[model samples]
Target: MIKSMTGYGCGARDNHKVKYTVEIKSLNSKFLELTLRLPKAFSDKELTLRSECTRLIERGKVNITVTVEYVDQTAAAATINTELLKNYFRQLEAVANELGTNRGNLFELALNMPEVISHNEEEADEEEAALLLNAFQEAVAQLNEFRKDEGVVLKQDLSTRTQDILRLLTEVEAVETDRIPLIRDRISQYMDETVGKENVDMNRFEQELIFYIDKLDITEEKVRLRSHCNYFLQALDAADANGKKLGFISQEMGREINTLGSKANHAGIQQIVIRMKEELEKIKEQLLNVL
Candidate 1:
């Protein structure tokens, strides 16, 4: 069955020292477009993680995000500069005194200044890196399962619509049977009005009418359209992803339906052709999301 490109999955794992959470999201696209968001500490493992993700997912616009939290806040907290804090306080205190404002709470203001706080971003050690990769692989597996479930629903919808077009083809054949006599009678009447009925040769008129009707025959179009519809259904049963293959088959189906419509001069057959086109348009729209 075909899998859908739209899905989401999440996974988390925690060591005694830190907790790691991984999330995966995807949407439909013609090619793979991947983006990763990670904490500064784990920047070195980005390329390895990216390669793994590419091997797992073949298509879609994908995003992977990782978050981490230390078990002990005091061990991983930001460091403050005492001298920068003191310098900021002195300048701010002088300005406040000149304005005659209250001098209290100056220390609170200085603590929040830009240069007063700084934290060194560290590199991910071997243990932490392994934990994150394990969590990420679990997330990718869950996302693939989500896609398989959605694929079953898509297969059902597409099969139903293709059957509908087949039913409509039967209707076109029924309406076509009664059309030739009407065309022949209209042409005979026109000849009577212009050249007089007694002056016309019946044998020659019948021969020309047969040749003209042959040009309007749609037998070949109907045969080709039915074949294309069957091929579309077969592609859905394949184990591998066949989204691009299905798209090409549908284009061929459209060409046959259009030919049918052009050869059908009767109003009833033309209307049936329009309905078939409607079903085909819907199939194309749904194929955009298939994987």
Candidate 2:
């Protein structure tokens, strides 16, 4: 069960003349990095919201936005700064008297200063808070649903690619087996060319041939590659949020593949190694989105 790290979901609830909306967006990340946007009144709930998102999404660069709108007049509570206004008026009266300028609009000018008409950024009631949190929960659920759906497609493609790698491995094995007899014949021909056919040292030649063939043998690489494939599938099954683990396994798989390529002296085996590398590359691309 693989899940993509990219998804989006939005949920909204309106009640008692207040409307709460929550939206979540996720993108691939090396770790769980969450950014939350909320009204000042709800700032205290940031940690709670982030924690809930972490538990749900597991890994990603997640951005969550919460908006609460008041549909009623009470939602906008304006407060006047009486002391500041009085002081402003007194200072302006003196300034106007000294400069011989009009003081008629001084009060209006003072009223327009920042913070003079402060309003309580609307706060949700307890019931409204519950609704908001519920909406957030729903958003996270929907986001994960989208990721899961994408994950199904990814899993199918990756499984196909894994099978392709296996096929290429089989081709490499065939090429490997065919090389041994070819090497024996070439060694015999070389011995005949260097020394007279009657003077050929059969025992020494056979031993040397065996040693050279063993050096070119990819049996260990094949065995380890096959084992890595099986281990990869097992890890995939056990993985919950194992993107990094999968990546590490991929590195090991690549090591074996590279070794197989380097040891391959046959043209067919080289071609198979190329195909295997292509499949592995595709798997690596898909792994980027896995969680």
Candidate 3:
């Protein structure tokens, strides 16, 4: 089944005093690219979170944002580092004495220095973190489900486009068969007119006609294009991410279609080639969103 690379999923859960919300957005890409925005407290889980997303999403350019709202007011308290402050105070007192200045408010000055007032946050509880992980998993699962549903729609649209191309191919093939004999007869008449009727060698003319017809023949191109169309359908049916593979196949199909256009010299065949190109272009545009 095919899945689109574009989708959105959001989830939220509250545990004790912390409320967590996870939002994920994905877009088409040649490789798996991930960008994450998370709270500073959860920075330790960055690698693990990215790994989990990689394992679950498979492929795409995915952006994940995690928002944490702490509901509790009792955050860690800030306190002066008494020992460090004392050391600073002692050094300052020595310098002040040499300079003949009073050591007034020296402790207060030392306390104002950075890292002096440490919050000494409590160690994060592993269980609470586990809850967060579980919530994240649920959110990812919901995201994948949304993508799957979107994929069903994409699959139907792409299949219809493929059928359109096949129909055009059939039309072109029919026109080529009818055009070949007429082209050969016209060539023969032109040759007979240029040379005297009796001087025109019928056997040699027939040989040249065969060679000319063969050069303009698109039978091989039609066959290869049809085969490519069939393979595209097969790839779409497989239960894997086949966006890149589908893109490659479409390129090959385009190659055959272009070759057919170049070889088709008949007005009818050229008209059909134009229609075939239109259909193929539509298919290629749609394939960009598939995975």
Leading candidate by TM-score: 2
lDDT of 1 by residue, 162-202 (tens): 99999999898888888888889889999999998998998
Look at candidate 2 and tell me the lDDT of residue 272. Answer: 88
Counted clashes in each candidate structure: 0, 0, 0
Which candidate order results from sorting by TM-score in descending order? 2, 3, 1
Candidate 3 at 247: error in angstroms? 1.5
List the candidates ranked by lDDT, beginning with the highest. Answer: 1, 2, 3
Q: What clash pairs does model 1 have? A: none
The candidate, 1 or 3, that scores higher on lDDT is 1
Give me candidate 2's TM-score against the actual structure: 0.87
Model 3 regions lying over 4 Å from their true place: 76-113, 116-123
- Winner by lDDT between candidate 3 and candidate 2: 2
Residue-wise lDDT of candidate 3 within 139-226, one digit each (tens)? Answer: 8878888888988888888788788889988888676667787887788788778886699888898898899988988889989999
Q: What tens digits encode model 2's per-residue C-alpha lDDT throughout 68-103?
A: 777785876678989888877788889999999988
Where in model 2 is the C-alpha error above 4 Å? 92-109, 112-114, 122-125, 187-200, 237-241
- Compute the lDDT of residue 190 as modeled in candidate 1: 94
